[model samples]
Target: MDRATWDRVQVLLGQFVYRSHQMRYAGELIHCGHCGSPITGETKTKKNKKTGGDKQYVYYRCARYNDEDHPRIRMTEAEIDEQILALFDRMRVEDEEFRNTFREQLRRATNWDLGTETKNED
Candidate 1:
């Protein structure tokens, strides 16, 4: 096969393998906090009004909604992201260098800078 065709085959094979793995182990992705039932993530895409671009939204919803007894559970991607940020924010290490690196990463992820904050406060 030609190089381009071989590369395309490899990409397709990789996607197929990834999807197969996800299908096999998808049950472990999320679970309902209340009833211990499985949850599935879904995504929706919409166009941005201001930018005229596509934006995707993700959420995890309980799979057992049809059941009468199980309470419904839904979580937005933003909420999950916030929780993850909070988790990273609370993380601490004994090493000073590691702590500084972690802090820098957090600031970068949040688009925050100490200089900007200081200037804003003045």
Candidate 2:
């Protein structure tokens, strides 16, 4: 395959594997609060000779870590999951206007247009 085709194939394969891993670890769904980029997870396994098994370590890292100015930011999967859960617990959903705004933002992010009527009504 040409370099472009090979690159595209590699990207597609990586996406498939990442999505599969994400489904298995749902609570790890997170984006970078700093740059709005999706976060990716990495796993490392080491052999444990005594137990005849592998020790696994998982990390959730920001995707925009290419810049040296931005220090590498990462968290253990468990830590990030727990922190997210805690955030949800403390979050308040009582603001109607905020909820509506957030819903509209989500719709826009998905490229769904809000009709003029809806805007006028708002």
Candidate 3:
């Protein structure tokens, strides 16, 4: 196959694989606090009577949620996002020395030198 056709085939295959396993935070990002199991995402569609449409919602819950004596706690994606944001907010650095160290480490990790760069006004 030609280069363009091969690239298109690769892109289509990637999209198919992504759609087949569309859970965003299923494996590594979160775990169940109560059961210590990985959290999995699910999508649910609810029919809207007033609007005559279907509203889809994503939720995350423990993989063992179906097991007996589970906590039965399922959180929507929005709730998980809010919790993550709150966590980041709590992780803000107050000490100047620690902040500087963190900034340097982040710069090194990302291989970017923001301090030495100048912005163009034009």
Which candidate achieves the best TM-score against the true structure?
Answer: 3
lDDT of 1 by residue, 68-112 (tens): 887665555334434545655576778989877755654454333
TM-score of each: 0.46, 0.47, 0.54
**Lowest lDDT block of 10, candidate 2:** 113-122
Point out the higher-scoring one by TM-score: 1 or 3.
3
**Model 2 misplaced stretches (Cα beyond 4 Å):** 1-28, 93-122
For candidate 2, the TM-score is 0.47
For candidate 3, lDDT tens digit of each residue in 47-121? Answer: 668999875556678999999999878875435534543443456678978866644443342233222222221
Q: What tens digits encode model 2's per-residue C-alpha lDDT throughout 1-122?
A: 35543443343334222221332232334567788777777666666578988655555667776767665776653354345334434557799787666444433422221121111110
Comparison by lDDT, 1 against 3, better one: 3
Using lDDT as the measure, name the better of candidate 1 and candidate 2: 1
C-alpha lDDT of candidate 1 relative to the true structure: 0.48
Q: Which candidate is the best by lDDT?
A: 3
Each candidate: what lDDT? 0.48, 0.47, 0.54
